[model samples]
Target: MTVKPGSIHALLGGNGSGKSTLIRILAGVERADAGQIDIGGAQFAAHSFNAGLAQKNEVHVVHQHSSTFPHLSVAENLSLGRGYEASIGGRILWPTVRERARRVLARFGIGASPDQLLSSLRPAMQTMVAIARALQDQEGSATGLLILDEPTATLSSAEVARLADALRRYAAAGQTIIVVTHRLDEVLDLADHVTVLRDGKVAGDLPREEVTHETLVQLIAGNSLPVSENRGQRRLAGRVLLQASGLCVGPLANMDITLGAGEVVGIAGLVGSGRTSLLRALFGLSRVSAGTMLFDGAAYGPADPADAVRHGIAYVPEDRLAEGTFPGLSVVRNVSMANLDRYWKIARLRTKAENRDAAAVADLVGLRPRRTDLAINQLSGGNQQKVVIGRWLLRKPRLLLLDEPTQGVDVGARADIHRLVRGAVSEGASAVVVSSDFSELAELCDRVVVLNRGRVIADVTADELTSDNLQQLAHMRIAA
Candidate 1:
């Protein structure tokens, strides 16, 4: 694969399709087994390229997490990888650092003050700060090959547009960029060229004018149908399973939601829109200051996660690596961790029974390699998510609260997970899903509840559900 100078190139692929691995190789975070790299008429062996070489070649990277210290000022964050200006007496030159930060922020159109804490800015502005810091040279000019991984994943639609415009301006000024993103609309609007990876290989490479949304999806997913297809056939049982009335929690105002038996309800919102807060409140991770909840025709207010579990509620958090999985443990242990009491018999753990149940769940989730003994971290992001969801499926809870269940998974694995959720619901369970991906919510949910500043502005049924509609509703401002 080749990237031309002075062009915005998009690196497109499904999860586990070699996108992250390739990015790591280019950024010198990982060594490639065999390959050659060409940078500005210079050639180097891929294996010999290290962080030092990448820096010397003007290669810079900004990750999805932004890699910024929230508590630190914007000037401090900009001065991180690069050294600070120091006086002859070894005192740091604060004015010099702030001046340099101001120039870079202005050049990138980032609406952030140099002295302001990074956490004080909006999510989009924080991402722009990271990008500006990466692309800015010592001369305060954008003059390098910048690579960004999922930079807009957390931003709202309007914020994404602003960032895309900044990138376009940078590319026009002869700065080469490689953007790794899952959103196809971003590729169409921002990229000059596109390279797609599938199963660790280049599946397609096309010019921007030659690519369309359908063609890109076909390249990334191959022949497998999208999970969104066949949404018309799914039917929800006409019985309410869970209900919340005037629910008030952190960032959540008088919100009301109802989940039907064998139904999947989606919560759609921007950052801090109370999507995750709703899930946490239901899972008993957050205290509900006011309001009432009913589950299966009974008043339900779980004191804690253990209490929620005892009451037959399961929650899959948004950050799977941080909250869902035990990194070093085997798939079997991770799957059975939530329900260990089932294997405890007479003060002795029933290893065989645990393994048997885990294996069944692995099969149910279509876990690749079919090895329950493998470490949970060994699996790809998609499979790791599968293991996390499988853990909840093993217990067969009455109401499942999934926060971004398919956030970083591949198309195939996403379909598998959606099928698994639908199957569980078909067996009389109910689900409340929170996802930033509007398309996923439109496809997988029977009804979508749109939240803005913690209030339910719209509840859209499946017949009226579409990615565009969800986005429009979430961005709408309603008078209090």
Candidate 2:
């Protein structure tokens, strides 16, 4: 496939669709056994990093996570590839480095000063700094390439717009850009051409004018995804299973929440708006400074997570990698970790019984490639999440809490997760979910509680809750 010069091309696909492999090949991190790479119409062996280095001045790559040293200044990050400014006597030249950083910042129209620490910048600004550093080595090259992988995965819509604007400036400056992302709106908004991959091959390649969101989704999933379900139609029994009033926990102030039996309630808010904090509090991961809570008609103050779990409360944390599942354990082990008591007999572990139960729950949660012995880290993000959430499902928990349930999940896996959640609710489990994706809340929740600055500003029921409604409510609260 030939990419147009000076165009912004979006590479999109579901997880495990070889998008990352292709990128690795392009970035010279992997050697291709077959086929050759042609950069600017010049053919090179796709066997090693040497080929990539031959065109080093013309190609730059910025990954999803910033590689910049947080404690260092922007100037230091920019001077990493290029030599640092040093005197003949081997003294560092801060002025020269800062001046160089200022020139690159000016070229990119970034407002950050060279001496400013990278960690002090906003996420969007830090991303811009990374991009600026990538371009610094190529200085005045008009026919260069900039590749960004999932640049806005963690950013809000507003921050995404800022990053898009910076990328557009690079494209306008005659740099060919390739962005690898799963976000459809971003592809439509920023890409001149879109390429979809499926099963290690290109499925669809279309110009910006030819692709719509529906078409892109179809290409990615290879089928029609289910329409958003009418959450209001689901009957939620009004038996309150969990209640909190005057709840205050680590930046959350006087928050009130009510969760009925078999109901899925979503907490919607921007980053740093106490969404995750509230989930942590509900799951007993955080200490409540002052609050009143009742669980199953009894006082609910968990001394720790163990107390919460013993009381039939299960939590799926936002950072799946760090807090949700143990990566080194097998899928069966991870699934059964929460219910080991069931498989323990006096002095010995019932391994066969544990595996049987783990396999059963794995099937129920629709865990793909259902191998009990595979390491949890070997599974995709969605499968790992299923293992995490599925652990609680086996326990017949009275309450479940999920934070960013599908943050980095692909469309197919996300659908599977939603089906699992609905199945759990059908079995009468009460759940509280926290997510930044408004559409996810609108699709899954019976009610959405919008938070702004640690306070509940609106409790929108399913019938009244649309993506636009949630966005407007949250934005207006912030504006107010």
Candidate 3:
């Protein structure tokens, strides 16, 4: 789809759908083997990818993860390129640079204490810095073709609204904008034009008025996804293997829950509704301000990930690549990473016996029977995710925590993961699965706890789960 001047356009798709690839091609990060791109009526024949970057079209692309030098202060990162422009004499006046950095960061709702290191802030705050740095031009106008790839991923609704307003204002001031997102609701409201990419190709290009949420859904998934069955009762509340009493993290608060052995519990919430924080805290990634988590009738407080893993609480984070598996690492290593204690002693030396153990678990997860040296990166995206889950499967935890377990995985592999989840249950292990796709929760979980702004809105059974119910719990106000 051609982006007109001063238009707020959107590229929408699921993971590996070429949305990132297309954006990278446009940003000159990667080259397109075929097709020519026309920018603002300029037909740039693609000889080399860098040719587009050198054109100086005032283009800036912010990817999903915030790219900030963690050791550097937020103010310092924002003012990195600005220093060349803000310099007075041959030398950069440090005090003047600090003064200008605060002004630039303030525009993005960020306070500039120019010396604060990036590591001191949260991931979302770091993302705002990347956005601020992208807009560090004079009159805040460097984003002639500002491309925000999942900018609202880690943001709250209010923050996303602020960014949507900012995009509108940018478009108002004659700046072209493109937002690459998976959320269809945001596109209907914030985007002026929408282009759907399926299988590394453009499937549909339509104006905002011409596209409905249903239309976009059908286009993206090819057809409507099947509705999950409203099956069996909450018959098996056998024993509370994992207990959360007054679990309060950032947005989650004052919650009481129990997961029985041989059962699955699902957590449903909007992207910003504190679902991620709830799981992270359970896994000991985030701080748990108030509440106690009891594992097998014992108080559990994980000092770190090692503590969590050692205690048999394996968590698969939302960003699978970041939290789940090492891509470049071999499949053998991916599986063995979790169960290293079984092999390693006082030394970090890996054993061949442990390698055989890893291969056995991989085969169990339907990851083909192969040599122990197969690189996980060389496998398909779905298989890579399987390797992640397979690795955790080797843990054989009593309680499993899965957040968006199949986000980027394909349809078939999704079923495979569900089977593996059931396999865990058969082994007398319970699980608490966090997923935005409510149907998935219905299919794989025995019960679901719907959260809104960190509070448990409703605790529902699998029989009561549906898209409408999930939407009501996630979006509309639940009756107090």
Candidate 4:
């Protein structure tokens, strides 16, 4: 198949459909055992980064989790590809450098100052900074190719619009843009051409205007998934497992909340809202400057994560690779991580017999066929997610914190995760889930609390929940 340049092309498919694999190959990070790359009408060697570099700085890729020094300032990050710091006879200056940084950021609608550290920004803000680098390098340069792999997975809809606009401008500026995303709506709006990959090869190809949503869904997912609406009403009056009064942090405040045993409260918000921070404050990752937390009818605000875990409060963070799964360890080890102290014998490692028992728990969580010997990376994406969730479920927390737990998961895996979460609650675990998906909040939550910017805007029960309602509440300007 022949591909063209300077067009907004998309690789559309479900989870494990080889979208990411293709991206890795194109980005010069993965070697395709057999195919050659042709950039700007010139065929390059099959497995060579030098060839990629030779093609006029051909490609730039942005991944799901960022790769940067977290402590570095935004200027430092943007300057990674485009130089801002100069030798200048061994002298350093700030204002002139940051002035250039601001000008570059405006090109992509990032709108952030240079002196701010990357650790201070949200994921979307960080992404904007990253995208600005591409723009910076492309100015008067020959960067003809760009690859985006799941770029909008963690972004809110509004941020997606901004990022999409930025990419569209880049394409209009005569660069080839290739996107890989499961978000069909984005594909419908932003793509000029679409390619569906099923197993390892192209399943179908269609021009953008020719592709309809239903037809695109048919190509990627084949058939729609079953929407399980069999959930019973939340009992609503079990013993209070967790209560937070006046929970105040950087962007979260006046968050008086109470969760009973078996209850699941979902906080829906946009990208910059304080849902994750709120969860962190409760889990002791973020400092709750002013709040009183109560667990099991007792006053409880732990000094740190260790104490929080000891008190049976678990958090599954938004950045799964960074905060959830241990990619370096075995499947048994990753799943049994949260409560490793349970299997330990006074500072010494557990015996092979105990390790095998951990593998049995892994099997219970549907990570079978490959056991303790298998590396955690060997499992498929869905199975990896199951292992991460199960690791915490095995801890039997009184309160679970789930932040965008289903972000990168496919529809089937999302349904399975929802089922698993509800199962955990049925077995008497309470949870607070933070999701950017309004549809998911309206579906799985017993009660929905919408946070806009930094404060609660609306609190609605499942009886009053709808996708439109949650979206409105999440986007509304609530009076401080």
Q: List per-prediction Cα lDDT, in the order shown.
A: 0.84, 0.81, 0.75, 0.74
Q: Which has the better TM-score: candidate 1, or candidate 3? A: 3
* Positional deviation of residue 266's Cα in model 1 after best superposition, in angstroms: 9.6
lDDT of 2 by residue, 1-480 (tens): 668988999998765678888877787777788787778877777775453464563677789866888898889988887778999998989899899889999988888999889889888888999888877766687666778888876676688899899888888888899999766667888999999997798999999899888777667656423337544355555788888999998557899988899889989865556788777877778988999999978998988888999998899998889888889999888987899888889999899988998889888878888887999999999899988988888998888888888878998888888887888888878888888677788888888999875789999984677765665555442432
Error of 3 at 50 (Å): 9.0
Candidate 3 clashing pairs, residues 3+ apart or interchain: 251-454
After superposition, the stretches of candidate 4 with alpha carbons farther than 4 Å from their true spots are 1-132, 138-228, 368-370, 477-480
Lowest lDDT 10-residue stretch of candidate 3: 224-233
Candidate 4 lDDT, 1-480, residue by residue in tens: 445677889987644568877777776777777767777766777667443464355577767665766799988887775565666674545677788788787766675778889889876677767766655756654356677777886666677787888778777877778887766667888999999986566778999779887676566544423333754456584888888888888677667888878888999876556788888888889888887888898888888999999998888888888788888888777866787776777787675745776666566565645566677777777777877887788877778899988887777778778877888888888889998766677678888888776777788884567665664455454443
Model 2: lowest-lDDT 10 consecutive positions = 223-232
Q: What is the lDDT of residue 226 in candidate 1?
A: 38
The lDDT of model 4 is: 0.74
Mind sharing the TM-score for model 2? Answer: 0.61
| Best of the candidates, TM-score | 3
Instruction: List all candidate RMSDs to the true structure.
Output: 7.1, 7.8, 5.4, 7.8
Assess candidate 3 and give its lDDT: 0.75
After superposition, candidate 1 runs with Cα above 4 Å error: 87-90, 138-142, 225-239, 243-281, 284-294, 298-311, 325-397, 402-480
The best candidate by lDDT is 1
